[model samples]
Target: MAQQFVDTKIKGDKVVLFMKPTCSYCIMAKDVLSKYKFKPGHLEYIDISGRSDMDSLQDYFLELTGARTVPRVFIGEECIGGGSDVVALHKSGKLEGMLKSIGAM
Candidate 1:
């Protein structure tokens, strides 16, 4: 079930941010994502804040990624850690390559 949850998110969006809508770090992540030039099918925003399974989903993420934190990010099938990681990649010019590799650019 954890794998399925991950698979669905990775396959469903070019960049999936497992985050709370009001999380400060999540907001930071969102700001970073907005700077990218993703393709048409990419979902720019999909809020998962008030879901009934929110807590369980976080648990599943801990099992899947070894981290249970908001702003858990996925690029394609790869888990890219949290907001700071994303910012680091962006600053290092690595995020663009990742986006291109996934055809999100």
Candidate 2:
């Protein structure tokens, strides 16, 4: 199921971005995540924009985490919301700690 894939990817990948290639928010989210300077191969971006399964996949995401938008950023299995949320985390000075907690830094 879609939920299974999401869970698997979130847990298996240190940084997972369920994004849409043409989404502005996705672009911004990518930029924000890039600021962390994660080691090579640490950041894994999954662009689901044109994927035929995106609808069901997104629905599953909404149901699983109440997140309805693209760029569903997950850090070490924790759903961290979209671009604004990521920025908020960084601004609050908590993003680095979270990254370090997961050994991403």
Candidate 3:
């Protein structure tokens, strides 16, 4: 599973949301994004609880982005940081532009 997920070339409009299912922070982040009317297919949710695949993915995510938190996002191979960063970008009116630039919007 880990290998498959990692190897996956993320179809069109790449956006990944790495989070655990029960994490409120994760849920909030996703909710906020949804509230913005982002389409359902705009993001990929990788849940990391007891799943080894997720654990491995988390490790890779950390190594790749130097972040050790849930709800870390990647837009088209670009690390967009964690929930706070994402929300900050949205509040600053930069999120949409960034997404658009990356062809994720």
Candidate 4:
């Protein structure tokens, strides 16, 4: 439920990272975000497999993002897609800029 996601971890931050625990791409995304100084409190990660609320919320997230994949990110409620997309943004040196623009980094 939305309330559950709000209660668990993603509600406060402007950028949320929906990721799985054992996913390599997810790990890389986290690393990249950290390397860019996104910092600890600036990000949120959800493991859909472990939490029932997250599993249910994935549908809503997919509906918003139009992508059924882990590592679906949101910056100020803007859906930013999966890992490859995040990596691409980072590679282009635009990811950090975007975070800065949003006052998230």
lDDT of 2 by residue, 1-105 (tens): 777777778763388889988899899888888888786777889988777778888998888779778889888887888988888898899988888788776
Measured on C-alpha atoms, candidate 1 has an lDDT of 0.79
Could you give the candidate ranking by lDDT, starting with the highest? 2, 1, 4, 3
For residue 94, model 2's alpha carbon misses the true position, in angstroms, by: 1.0
- Name the runs in model 4 displaced over 4 angstroms: 3-13
Q: What is the per-residue lDDT of model 1 for residues 23-83, given as tens digits with 9 covering 90 to 100?
A: 8888888889889878887644546678777677788888878998888888876789888
- Provide TM-scores for the models: 0.88, 0.89, 0.79, 0.81
Best by TM-score: 2
| Residue range 1-105, candidate 4, lDDT tens digits | 654563355443467787897888888888777776665577666666677566556677666667667877777657778888889999998887888877777
In order, candidate lDDTs are 0.79, 0.83, 0.72, 0.72
Winner by TM-score between candidate 4 and candidate 1: 1
Cα lDDT tens digits for candidate 3, 1-105: 554575474444667777887887788778756655455567677676877566677777777789667877777777788878778888999888777775766
Note the clash tally of each candidate: 0, 0, 0, 0
Candidate achieving higher lDDT, 1 or 3: 1
Give the poorly placed runs of model 2, Cα more than 4 Å off: none
Candidate 4 overall lDDT versus native: 0.72
lDDT minimum window of 10 residues, candidate 2:
4-13
Which candidate's lDDT is highest?
2
Instruction: Tell me the deviation in Å of residue 10 in model 4.
Output: 5.9
Point out the higher-scoring one by TM-score: 2 or 3: 2
List the candidates ranked by TM-score, beginning with the highest.
2, 1, 4, 3
